[model samples]
Target: MRLNIHTLIHPTIQKLAYEIIYQKSHKKLQNTDNEKTLGMLIFYEILRKWLKIDNIYIKKVDVLKERRLSNQLDKYLIITNIIECYNILADVQRILPEPYLKHIDFNNINNSFYCNEKLQEYRIIIFEKFLKNYGIIEIINYLQKNNQINLNHVKIICLTCNSNILKYLANKYPQLNIYTIKIN
Candidate 1:
């Protein structure tokens, strides 16, 4: 899927996923069956709360069957449950988008700067872990390192605990496009 910063879920759901991951880590749960069960519970609870429904539940087998059917029909499986969500997010440690230099040619310039640049229009730096002091250093470091690139085209993707600090950051770095993604 062509997911941007908007693909992230709500903050409450993100916190719940973090809690699930923390529990799984402490218990050393290695079985996918159990993981799926736990994931289902969270997913069901979120849906129930959001929809304002009571005691809504779905079987793991049914979910899997629907996923397969969706795949057969050439449709995207929207919800892969919380564990899959966490796994997908955890794997992506960093995403430094390519800089769209108006005049610079790639033939002479060093390509070491962005070996994994997927999107070229905007530079996106992702942080799966908690931000250091609300990501002030990271933002500054990115701007400094990519001083050759224009700040207006950059998109800083991070997970921050504080929304107020995020607002502050948005104001502080008006040149860059800062996006806070919530973990699902």
Candidate 2:
């Protein structure tokens, strides 16, 4: 139940951010006035630096293939700045079940925090692709396995084009929020 800045962020991410921002590299961040806002920026920049430095990222770097990641990174940067809030998602992004949290926007993540149409659309793209690669069983397993809590506590996001799956999950867990592309 640790809840501090250091505990909230992973050591690797902290090191990457620190080294890139202050220690090894002399890169200037987008916002220097507020350190908290730098969390997401640094995470994205780590991806940038890895793309240039890491052997795997370098070899596997495909601009077209990583379009989904790039798209979310854009929204991540946008929402991080506009919302002025950073919590579990920033930490979870760098440290997660597999650090594959590209779909759920960190900003609008809350139990009662209804996602907007555009955000839902963005997530559907991510979820659909994920479902294609790894079937529903795997997706649910991953979602069910995650135990990290955001600032607003935490909740599992179930998205499906199948109304049957939605209904099944809803009836199974009434309190949980199961989202469709059309839901507000």
Candidate 2, 10-68: lDDT as tens digits? 55444433443352135454333333344444334334422222222223555423222
TM agreement with the true structure for every prediction: 0.34, 0.23
lDDT of 2 at 34: 31
- Judged by whole-model lDDT over C-alpha atoms, candidate 1 comes out at 0.37
Model 2 alpha-carbon miss at residue 42, Å: 24
- Which candidate number has the best lDDT? 1
Q: Which candidate is the best by TM-score?
A: 1
List, residue by residue over 49-154, the lDDT tens digit for candidate 1.
2122124344685473222111121111121122224543322212111112222121232332332232332333332223324434343444446554455444
Ten-residue region with minimum lDDT total, candidate 2: 123-132
Model 1 stretches astray by more than 4 angstroms:
1-7, 10-122, 132-135, 141-146, 181-184
